[model samples]
Target: MTGSPWYRDGRMRYGVGIEDTFIPQERIGHRKLDEYELTQHYARWEADLELVAESGAEFLRWGIPWYLVEPAPGRFDWSWTDRVAAKMQELGLRCIVDLMHYGTPLWLENSFLNAGYPERVAAYGRAVAERYRHVWTDFTPLNEPVVNAEWCGLTGSWPPYLVGDDGFVTVMMQLARGMVRTQQEIAAANPAAVFVHVDAGFRYEGETSPVPRAFLDERRFVGLDLITGRVQTSSVLGEWLASHGVTAAELQWFRDNAVKPDVIGVNYYPGFTTARIEDGVMTPVRSDAAGLRDLVELYSARYGGVLAITETSLVGTPEEKIAWLRDSTAELTALRDEGHDIVGYTWFPFFTLVDWLYRYDQKQPDEWFREFGLVDLVRGADQGLERVRNSAFPAFRELAIRDR
Candidate 1:
């Protein structure tokens, strides 16, 4: 785990992740939402790392809040992160550090659309790599670029708000550029670094839909395609992007400086990963193991590299959660048996997290809490939110130990 890359270790790795999104901006009347604060992770980070190690997980996908770490243009405060990184290494847990989750520093004027975003984010990536190259080697430049663009561009819920397909394309271009530069910076610092490009695995269904299934399917891979330089003029999404205002030179820029992921981490939740779009309205369709298998196969066929279920879980009763753990792992095992390069499976967010809706509504964290982890969060009057281990904890531990 220390010298060689874990994905190259010839084992099906098992890991857990903490929900580490830090959107620090409040638009309209909405309040900012930081998962670490809501879950008290900052105060109890040591205990949280211990809990992850205790669960028999070898890896942890966590993020550093850029807004807090870099309050000024050229200054950084790594005191808190230095401790967390040290503790993670001490616990023998391999860290796949998430460099960007959603938000940027308040000092960054226009968020993702800012002309200097790519360079600024790359600078942060370089600093992180230089600081913790020994403690961890895996890095995710940004988590869920599609979701980032959706919230910030398509829906106009986040910073530098721009709506419609044009906005999404604009934001995606900036993200892809930043991601490429971030990967380059991290590699310059640590030549042996591994990049796990993580994104939400979106699946759209419905024969009589407003958006063509073919287009949506192709669109799902647009973010990944852009980074890897797969969106050429002859590609399916190439013309669509051009029609939206992307020029030939902009498309060629990605081709000239493409950065392919060592492992494509697709975050899939059976409860809401797949959807049915009808007459322009989209509805979440609850899917099961079969749905997961389809997504794994799709990504594998497209990227043809090491693939991992970077995030997946059910927000349901203990029984339902346990069932998903059994079913999903079984399907992945079958895929591995059939010669798929599926290297890892991660039950994301080791504990509960505040729902994203909490940011737009004035409600207590407990009210908007989601039970998607092996551990549950309970509100304590004196101690804030307490981490309580539920039945799924032991179940997931058993799977991790048995699988690894």
Candidate 2:
């Protein structure tokens, strides 16, 4: 998977995300999962992925938990990563490695409130990049900064559980800096590498952007600019930032130091979007997953880069999910016909995830996040856990191959 030649048009290129690839056994150590339990879990994940690769996906995007990577701030693990990378290479798939997918090493305690966290993360990042450079091609420094920052830092909604807005700004800026730095190191080692500034595809129902309220767009593109170094301290907007204690010097520094993502990844999901929240269920209002093709064109125009929908799922109800996927694929084809840089389309995870973070049993019970996957997590006494592949699997397989 490392150092493979990929190209777009005449240049080397490919599209597709690595699916159902996070490991429970590796990051937290074998403590969370037993060897006896993983036999089917690992196999199913690999099988579904191979199926996606067969659909003409050039590379897969997956992450390693920081908590799992470095048990201590400086210490690291390479064994689990090596095995996964090798498997990907065996399957003839290149990989886009995501360093921290919103969470940090448990030792860091998910400390978004601290300014120093990102710096330490960068040090660890440099090491991880050097190690994985041998196995992966591209890299994503942080995934979904807007929501991640909000959940982990600003709103005090997630782990490390801090309250107040002060931490949010600090954490986001640090991440912006960290991502730029991570890409720099990775680029230095592998001069040909590209960085994907990956963003969650959902919009907040507030201020400026797409959501009904003006606040929706208010924070919509916030993540992109932060990573690209667009936020500054001296402007009118800087005043608002100052309310949270962002200083002029730091803001200017970030603006001057912004690092642009080589490819901007738009990761989509079904859970966050809504029609009218009818009866508290987020019905599909405007969705490519529903054959309502405009969103594809909207995104293509919004971000002028080789575009790919990183993760799109029709969460809940196997039948609905299947129908949504079929619609999404067909709509993607339409976008391609319209000459959108529609590099490639993807329906992700290929398998089920470790129960979604967004949908906890106690929290957001109505959202149904776990059902977005293409497989059902079922364990058999003899087989361990198996991915009872959904009906959409065969349909997607058939479509993906037709073009691949």
The residue-level lDDT of candidate 2 at 353 comes to 47
Question: Quick one: best lDDT, which candidate?
Answer: 1
**Which sections of candidate 1 miss by over 4 Å?**
1-4
TM-score of each: 0.98, 0.79
Model 1, 1-404: lDDT tens digits are: 25877787778888999999888887777789899999999988999999999999989999999999999987999999999998998899999999999899999998998999999999999999999988879999999999999898888888878898999999999999999999999999999999999989998766637668988888888888999988898777999999999999999999999997999998999878998888977788999888888998999888898999999998999999899999999999899998888888999989999998899888888899899999998877895778899999999899889876
Candidate of highest TM-score: 1
Q: Would you give me the overall lDDT of model 2?
A: 0.59
Candidate 2 has a TM-score of 0.79
Full-model lDDT for every candidate: 0.90, 0.59
Clashing pairs in 1: none
